[model samples]
Target chain A: EDKVVQSPLSLVVHEGDTVTLNCSYEVTNFRSLLWYKQEKKAPTFLFMLTSSGIEKKSGRLSSILDKKELFSILNITATQTGDSAIYLCAAPNNNAGNMLTFGGGTRLMVKP
Target chain B: SQTIHQWPATLVQPVGSPLSLECTVEGTSNPNLYWYRQAAGRGLQLLFYSVGIGQISSEVPQNLSASRPQDRQFILSSKKLLLSDSGFYLCAWSKGWGIQETQYFGPGTRLLVL
Candidate 1:
């Protein structure tokens, strides 16, 4: 069975703190890993990591993939209340028409 | 630029009642469309996907059914609603057939069943 697991299901931190969210997966054929941020109703695309050892960054957010360990991590630096949301990690299920298999997600709360 | 739209931002339905949710995309053609449901504080569960017109692929078997009537339009319908069916429904579109593409999601429709 292919599944993705996230660590620290919920976290609360003060503004300006740095947080690392983890995601590990076990799948038959791994193609790519994606990260999304869900604020209220919709989830916006954050980053997509295909090759290991390559880091993808946008502003204060960064992510890396470790295929050997079957895991990925998302780091948010200089956190603000605007960054509070549910972070989701997902990967393509190679056996199932490339359908994405998503992790349970990590709820992040940045307090001022 | 591509955008997806979902109707009836919020809906309150009763158990055993019918359901009809619509999603349409603009500025793109022959794009891959997907429908997903998210429970409160939970991850997304893919319900259906369409590669092209008149093509519907279901990821899970449930009370819900989907249809792609046009190139950029996808619909999710249920003969009868269930309490468990209430959730946030989202529609997404990707550029091509490959899974390596990035998916853009709509604002989403919140369904509450009593």
Candidate 2:
């Protein structure tokens, strides 16, 4: 079974604080890793990591994938109240066409 | 710009009742569509996916089924609803089927089965 596990299921931080969310997975054939931000209803895309050691960054958010260790990390720097959301990590199944396996997600609360 | 739309943002239904949820995407052609369910405090579960019109694939065996009649329209249906079916249903679309592309999601539909 392909499984994606995330640690620190929930976190509370003050504005301007930096947080690191972890995601590790076990699957048949590893293709790529992705991150999403869910506020209330729908999840928006964040980053997709396909190569190891190279980090993908956007504004205050950045993510990196480690293929050898089968893990990834999403780091949010200078977090703001608007950054409060559930951060999700996922990877596509190699056998199934575009079928994604997602983590439980890390609930982040940024207090102003 | 691409956009995805889902109808009936919220729904409440009784057990054993039939259900239908609609989703449509625009500004894209022959995109890959997917249906997913998110239970309380759980990860997203893939229910179904379609690569093109009239092509549907079931990722999980459940009371729900999906159909893609048009290239950008997908529908999720259930003949009989179950209590376990209550959750946030989401629709997503990607560019192609070969690579792991970023999926654009719809606003989502919250279903409550009594």
Candidate 3:
């Protein structure tokens, strides 16, 4: 079975602090890694990393995948209270039925 | 742009009761659909997926079942609700079978079985 593990299951940080979330995977027929930000409802798509070394960035959030290391990291800069949410990482399995194996997720809390 | 929707934002049902959750997509044609369940503090688990109408594929066998009737409509049904079924149910969609394609999620339906 494909497995995805995330580090620091939960974290609390003050405003303006920087946080890095980590996700490592052991998957079959690996294709890509995806990141999402979930508040109280559905998870919103953040970034999709298909290559190694190249980082995908948007505003205060950026992510990079290290295929060789079989891991990915999400970086949040100058965090704000609004940045608090459960960050999820997923990897797609290329078997018969296309599916994504997701990590347990990292719950982040940014306090002002 | 495409959008996905799920109905009955919240539901509370007794054990052995029936269930029917609906999901629909707009502005897209022949999209792949999926059903996922997430327990408290757990990751999303794929329950079922459909590549086309009446072509449902079960990921994990359980009390739940799914169906895709129209091009954009998917339904999740259960003959009998189990307490273990109480959780957040999410519906998703993608463009094709490409493993690299990103799946978009719905608002989700919170089901509590007592």
Candidate 4:
């Protein structure tokens, strides 16, 4: 079975703090990794990582994937309360359903 | 721009009641549709997926079932709801049916089975 694990299931930090969320995966085959931010509703797309080493960034958020290491990391810099949410990491699997196996998710709370 | 919609936004029902949640995609046709459930503090679990009309594939075996009666409309149903059925139900769509395709999500429906 394909599995995705995330570290520090929950985090509480003050504004301006930097946090690094981790996600590791175990799949029979590798395709791509994805990041999503969920607030009180549906999750929105963040970044998709297909290659190792190179980083994908959007404003205060950035993520990197390591195929050999079988893991990925999402970094939030100068975090604000608006950045507070459950950060989810997922990997697309080679299943007939075109499914994504997701991590339990790292819940980050930014206190102002 | 493509969009997906799922309704009713919130539903509360007694246990053993029947369930029927509807999802539809607009601005696109023949897109791959998927149904997922997110329990409190858990990751999204794939319940069903449809590659085209009348082609539904279930990922998990449970009290839930799905149908895609139209190219853009998908439905999740259950003959009898269980308390375990309470969760956030999400619908998604993708242009292609591939592991690499990016799926866009709907606002989601919150189902509460008491």
DockQ of each: 0.62, 0.69, 0.70, 0.65
Highest DockQ against the true fold, candidate = 3
Scoring the B chain of model 2 against the true B chain gives a TM-score of 0.96
By summed lDDT, the worst window of 10 consecutive residues in model 3 chain A runs over: A91-100
Question: So what's the TM-score on candidate 3?
Answer: 0.97
For model 4, the stretches where C-alpha displacement exceeds 4 angstroms are B97-100
Model 3 lDDT at residue A39: 92
Q: CA shift at B36, candidate 3, in angstroms? A: 0.5
For A1-112, candidate 3 gives per-residue lDDT tens digits of: 8999998899999999999999999998788899999999999999999899999999999999999999999999999999999999998787545678899999999999
Candidate 1 clashes: the total is 0
Residue A23, model 1: lDDT of 99
For candidate 1, lDDT tens digit of each residue in A11-110? 9999999999999999887778889999997889999988999999999999999999999999999999999999999887753235677899999999
Which residue pairs of candidate 4 clash?
A: none
Quick one: best TM-score, which candidate?
3
Ranking by lDDT: 3, 2, 4, 1
lDDT of 2 by residue, A1-112 (tens): 9999998899999999999999999978787888999999899999988899999999999999999999999999999999999999988876434778899999999999
Write model 4 residue lDDT over A1-112, tens digit each, in one string.
Answer: 9999998899999999999999999988787888999999988999988899999999989999999999999999999999999999888778666777889999999999
Which regions of candidate 1 deviate over 4 angstroms? Answer: A95-97, B97-100
Kindly list the interface RMSD, in angstroms, of each predicted candidate in the order they appear: 2.1, 1.7, 1.4, 1.6
Runs of candidate 3 with Cα error greater than 4 angstroms are B97-100
Measured against the true structure, the TM-scores of the candidates, in listed sequence, are: 0.96, 0.95, 0.97, 0.96
Chain A TM-scores, per candidate, are 0.97, 0.97, 0.97, 0.98
| CAPRI grade of model 3 | medium
> Positional deviation of B65 in candidate 3, in angstroms?
0.7
For model 1, give the interface RMSD. 2.1
In what order do the candidates fall by TM-score, top score first? 3, 4, 1, 2
